[model samples]
Target: MTMLEGVTTRPGGRRPGATRTRVDILAAAQRSFAEHGYVLTTIRGVARAAGVDPALVLQFFGSKDGLFDAALRDDPPVRALVTLAGEGDPSDLGPRLAARYLELWEDPHTGPRMLAVVRAATAAPSASAMVTAFMTDEVMLPLARAIGADQAELRAALTGAYLFGVASARYVLGVAPLAALDREAAVTYVAPVVQHHLTGDLTPP
Candidate 1:
């Protein structure tokens, strides 16, 4: 059901090669956003990448933002996050989770895709609620259960807050201290904070 990178085809591409064409366009779109960021990316760039006509990108996603959303889930990032929340080791959940988050940003292809979504969602008040609700229900609920903790929802929110702060400083604002740290080092520091929220005993007063 999920399309490739930034490309999705409407299924009914029953005609000989319509499906393949749609996919190429989407993949191309993903590449453009990742390399150039949202501001610099264009439909033509994607088309060139995919070796397709520009109209195809528009035909598939309808707009650049639609394509942007599709690109973030190249290999089911959300599903992976949710699954990890349920099954990963409780003691190391925070660091593992942080590492996964960092991996997404480090991908270069998926990073810009996420940045575009975050920026757009932040700018729109309506989308903010939707994004928040999705992260909590899908990610936090399961994460809380994995840690065998009560008040899963609150814990999930706390985890999300921690993630948001780190991501904003390291990626969006490019804060020197935060951005300078490599992924492993960042995870080492971030994991404990996340563990505390998830386990409720990772830190002392």
Candidate 2:
């Protein structure tokens, strides 16, 4: 099944006319999770940000885990990548993924949220686990299976490592050379390495 397949939206809490409140809570949660990660973000923090009672957050989300899970589903970058992955030839998945990944980073709408997720993943254990599981189960496994690659799981891990490393260096850390490279230049150089990880032989170098 797809990673986000069965995720039902949470109920709008006990209050009537609570849609705006729920929306505010969710937006606050997103920024909080992005800024502080799972470990540091709390119901009170979210409530403070949303200017709502902490009880309201609890009523809406049930628990911190519930809120985190719902937030992930709310803005799944994987769903977008999955659509791009399935397009064009399967053998070209690496380049396709690279292109799409770059496009996502370049996108103003999605980039901030993705950056938040990445930041949280690096700083918080739960956030890291969430990202790892999402990538392994929702993303890499599906893509590997789609192309019938040998050592599919390993390939997925490797692909993730490569992609994440590049993203961190270029976007987060702002490494000089990599950061300097334009989008086309970045993809041209990185896609082949990604392709090799996806479909190439696994002999040790």
Which predicted model would earn the best lDDT?
2
Q: Where is model 2 more than 4 Å wrong at Cα?
A: 1-14, 17-24, 35-40, 48-52, 59-66
Clashes of 2: 0
Best by TM-score: 2
lDDT of 1 at 109: 54
How does each model score on lDDT?
0.69, 0.79
Q: Candidate 1: where are CA atoms >4 Å away?
A: 1-16, 76-79, 86-88, 107-142, 145-151, 182-184, 201-205
Instruction: Kindly list the per-residue Cα lDDT of model 2 for residues 1-205, writing each as its tens digit.
Output: 4222333334434544688878878888887776666678898877777777888889999988778867877757756666655677867877889988988887876777778777877876776787778777777778887787889999989988789889989998999999999999999989999899988999897
Instruction: Please give the distance, in angstroms, between residue 67's alpha carbon in candidate 2 and its true position after superposition.
Output: 2.5
lDDT per residue, candidate 1, 22-117, as tens digits?
A: 766666765565456556667777776676666767888777666655554445354466667656567777777888888887785567666755
